[model samples]
Target: MQRHSLSVSELTEPDVVRRALDALCREVDGEAAVAKTALRKRSAFSEVLGAAVGKGYFAENPLARVKWQAPGVSEEVDPACVPNPTQVACLLTAVGRQRGRGPHLEAFFGCMYYAAMRPAEVIHLQISQCHLPKSGWGMFNLSGGVVTAGKEWTDDGAVHEVDSLKR
Candidate 1:
């Protein structure tokens, strides 16, 4: 069998680095895939590049030395998506009216909108964690959340995987 792999010289080339950055900015699978590739993706690629430097494969990270303009992206949230207090109240009332899971999901949505909780955090919330005071503000701990990474990725062969809160 024949094997093909990129050599260290080919990997650190200017064209290869530019191609990767271009891919990050370009749409994939007919959808605009977002990436702050430097910060997000756990900086895995950067770490790899650093390893290359340590191994004397390169003098420096080629991507850092080069200057390129990424596509303009708005970081602000659109005002149209936000609901007013009155609208939120109306929505809550309507949610309570629906049958079965609606009543349960209303509180879930409240945690998302009011507390700005992630869905995973809401799902793993335990009643014991809540300190519901008689009058004033109550409190709860958000230690972690469960993620569904599918059976293939989990040790127990179950879909749900418990993980620490995101940074």
Candidate 2:
């Protein structure tokens, strides 16, 4: 009775692979999920299959041979969604008008808009990094940032993860 479940050969079979792909397609259909989100899941799975191929466990990644079609990903940026400089300034001022921490948050949002810093990068920015000048220009020395990567992937089981600036 215990020997029936072991069938590693079936993993590479075309029919079995197709059936699994079909099931995955059906399961993730609808529910407000985007095509990119679903494709990312497949890509993550492909990495594991790639490792199996490297270890000589298989001829190649099963995913590489399988004919699975992912939905089209749009790379274009919509100009209509982008706010003008004046619009951004006004929005920042409006946030400052709010009670309590709103005024403090305006500068935080400003750095994201003007300096092009990510939310995580802005959060970790310290006063020591600032090169604030009285006149012309100033700069910041950004070394690293923190982001949310979910608790399961982190060593401390915390949702936030620290990462160096990319690019």
Candidate 3:
């Protein structure tokens, strides 16, 4: 019960579809898309092609014949991209050299490097929670962080809401 001609065309070619999908697999910076994102796009495209076939626009799903696979996800970070302590110190120093906001952010970045605190946690840090002394080292009693959500998505209509620290 097909309404359209069965002739193959450039738009529906399997090779063309494969190439377009391959392009989608890589980001603009040439990095591969995350596994979950790529897989979701693939599934969505497949459904679209299935609908086209069901409506008699295509003879079959072209992607069904492609053998390409998405890149695997990994938790291991590349060591080369990691900055050493000296590099971090130099970066913090450079940040502190900026005119207006630099001096303020120097301590913020220091908390991230020295205490290994997340940006959110540092954002929510209070002066009262700091145990700074006239001595060697100081301590911070971190409680939670501030999470930004859309106003419509929040119960109180505030964009920034206090949330517990992530485990």
Best by lDDT: 3
How do the predictions measure up, each by TM-score? 0.65, 0.56, 0.54
lDDT of candidate model 1 versus the reference = 0.76
Give lDDT per model, in order: 0.76, 0.78, 0.85
lDDT of 3 by residue, 1-167 (tens): 35544344554876778876777687789988888788888898788789888988888887877788877777687979988999999999999999999987998999998999999999999999999999888999999999898798889999988899887
Model 2 lDDT tens row, 1-167: 55855365677987776665544443454343356666676777778778877888889888767787764545677889989899999999999999998987998998898888998998888999988899966898998898988999999999998899976
Candidate 1 local lDDT, residue 125: 89
Better of 1 and 3 by lDDT: 3
Clashes of 1: 0
Model 1 clashing residue pairs (backbone) = none
Candidate 2: misplaced stretches above 4 Å? 1-74, 149-153, 157-159
Per-candidate count of clashing residue pairs (backbone under 3 Å)? 0, 0, 0
Q: Go through the candidates in order and give the C-alpha RMSD of each one to the true structure.
A: 5.8, 6.5, 7.6
